[model samples]
Target: MTQATAQTRAFVTGFIPAIALLATVAPAHADLKICNRMSYVVEAAIGIDDKAATATRGWFRIDPAMCRVVLQGPLTADRILLNARALGVYGSSPIPQNGSDTLCIAPNDFVIAAARQCRQGQTAAPFTQITPTQADDGNQVAYLAEDSEYDDEQARLAGIQRLLVIAGYDAAPIDGVDGPKTQAALAAFLKSRGLSPEIVQSPNFFATMIDAVQAPSSTGLTWCNDTPHKVMAAVGTDDGKTVTSRGWYGIDPGKCLHPDVTGQPRQIFSFAEAVDADNRTIRLKDKPLNWGGATQLCTRESKFEINEQGDCGTRGLAATGFAAVDMSGGGKTLRFAMP
Candidate 1:
């Protein structure tokens, strides 16, 4: 189905009750109304062409005899003309032919008429998509002339009331109902918050309130495990340390232990052949090279002797007889390695 056909079907299926209710209660002439028969409320207005009659949904009441409409919502006087179109009333449209011809009808009269018509298989006329008129005094005057065609001010008021609730303001529940109390409360809220006190334009006030409440905190580190699989240590000679006659040397275990240099210290002892915490013996020849010197002895140089059970005694090698001797004058390196 076409979009227009779909909309009409939806409106017929969905909105019959509200339209019916409106039809029953609205006065024929003085009471002008726009019933939001849809699931959502719509801002709207109503008027007749050539008649100064206008009715806004929640904000204004029209007196056809007086040729005047009293606005209770937050709309500027000028914008009211534009808002009337949404009420199914537009420039120079004749009064609805089916409704009562009372000189003045209550706002509810229009609502009830619309509702009754919609229920009895009447559909709103398809909207003619008119190009916006060129900016001319005549166009402007024509636009204003049609202002009385609908009750948009009331629709705007109803919308404002809904927005106020959504925005957390203490407004009355929307019942397609309006009164002095509702108007007074809205006026107070707008005045206190420095908004225009009128209903035609008050919807933005509530929108601003919602924004103010929500705007403050609208944008918001991670860790991972990096552990080692094995721990190792190394022993090497520095020029600053002393070397014994037996050529025994001690390197401090705590000073050079780190991931890059050596793994964590497993255990500490005096000789290259000492067993680690796991009870594995340190095999001197299999030990990886330490930072101090080359792993292999030079050609013709004696292989390094490592003492496994050496103690720092007055005579060291005589007690253990186990030491890695680098017969080359330069020192040999020792490190922890898998046996």
Candidate 2:
């Protein structure tokens, strides 16, 4: 009887045009329906090219053995694009995306047009392409069967890590790779909650972890190193009134680092720079392995704290883009997942 819902908005063809095929069989009352056959709660997004323009909509929550109407009324679009994710307590999407077509999506209800890039306050994510099946009732049906579940070992393990991080355990970035850090965190989590260690060896372990993390945590900013190299991270917080930035916290490979900052803020910003053991930048295609955002902030080379938000050059501090972290529904724990 537990029902959850996520809304995705669609833009009319007057905004952006679709690039795919047009629907050959358009029914007068055609609708788009999604059926969830998985054990976990899944949310879905869809893209449609209604012959004139292409627009997408989604994040509809479909519980196990349930079906949800994604698009109602006449079928207009010929081809469809979809993306689904298993929701976590902290808004961690552990479901493996299965497509290459990128689309722009907002964290909340949105109906954006001309979405080829990640605009301000929006993020670009990949979605799967699916063909709508013409039903006998003239509606479209899309099945989210168990076979579509990303049940790989690495994916399952990463799902557990994401849950652990949300539950106050420092599992870092929920990268689908088994490491010593993940193992230790998992063990500690099992013991602290009185969960039998044997559950770790079962297929239900991932589900168990997800259920346990429903309770919120009180932890602060944490950075997880998901790459092969060591990463140094910086953090910034704005408590609706003032801004404070701090950093140069080094985190080893496959490990997590919790900053000294305590209590939750309204917003958090993060910047990550990957380097070698001797503190040399690692570059791929001449670009340094780093993560940041469009929000310009003041930073320094060494461990430093900057209370002021402006006058970076004049004050002898370097300026960099600190990406805003979406804490997923104002959750207390803010984790900067570095890849």
Candidate 3:
């Protein structure tokens, strides 16, 4: 099989469903969308005061009109805290890269701060700080009551399976639980795309995968950001100095604007020599080439040739000569041609 096909297969084998549940419940509304924008999803908890409270399993919605924290879940407990760092809602600090030093904030601190502000009839802060010890406190663990409703794992599995299939993976039917078959398919797909299969199993896997697929191309030959207005050349002068310009011959007004010329058309020419910044004249590579001279060089050298309009051209040569025929402006440095 070809390399592309092999990688595609590997990506399909290692897929896994992401977890959507969190320990803390937020208010019910439409404006609040969960932002799990990180590369890794993490499990967290919410605590009210020093006590751990069980929360309902549902999404949070923040409504600017009502300005209230509405709770919608299996459990109707009014006093609670929310803990779901994976959603990027509540966290102590930015997630760490190589270690866990930044994941020190506890859910309890957030809950207490919210409660205190609410009771005092003051607006609650967006986030609050929690200590490591308070984060580990068992009292902050909330338990779901018998009446509390939660999302079915089976439904989640089905949704994940459907998404995988849509992403071009041939995964099995949705089962609430993860299985070796699903893992194999995920692995195949990740490998094909040049990503780590092991990371795909993590909570942030889907986020990372989406980022990679949506990233812009980085090839230097293409214009920046794939815009059509830009053009680039790899030509160099004979003195080992490379000249890159935005448009044809680095002479278009839109391509280059110097004090020397106002609106010069793009054209290529051969020069006898060029003057440097210190006013020293430097000889160019080829003799002053008219259309005939350029055509002659094109025939003599197997690699050297004249392109359209009889401009000197070279194939695989390290350097080239560039000249501007119009010396309209007084700038001496810009008037000369360089080899």
- On lDDT, the candidate that comes out on top is 2
Q: RMSD, model 1, all Cα superposed?
A: 37.5
lDDT for model 3: 0.28
Model 1 per-residue lDDT at 149 = 28
Decide which is better by TM-score, 2 or 3: 2
lDDT of 3 by residue, 188-294 (tens): 66776687757744655545543432232221011111211211111111212322221111121122211111122343223222112111222236333111112
lDDT of predicted model 2: 0.60
Q: Per-residue lDDT tens digits of candidate 1, residues 1-339?
A: 233432322222211111211122111222122323221222333323223433222223221111223222322222222122212111011221222322212222243233212333223421111112212221211111221222445434554554444333445655435787667766655665666646434434433543322221111000001111112222222122322221112112221111111122222122232322221333347752222222221110011223232243432322322223241422122333324
**Winner by TM-score:** 2
Task: Note the clash tally of each candidate.
Answer: 52, 5, 39
Q: Which wins on TM-score, candidate 1 or candidate 2?
A: 2
lDDT of 2 by residue, 158-223 (tens): 556756765666677656567888889988888877988788777556556655553334445556
Q: How do all the candidates rank in terms of lDDT, highest first? A: 2, 3, 1
How well does candidate 3 score on lDDT at residue 190? 76
* Comparison by lDDT, 2 against 3, better one: 2
All candidates: CA RMSD (Å): 37.5, 15.8, 24.0
State, as a TM-score between 0 and 1, how close model 1 is to the true structure: 0.20
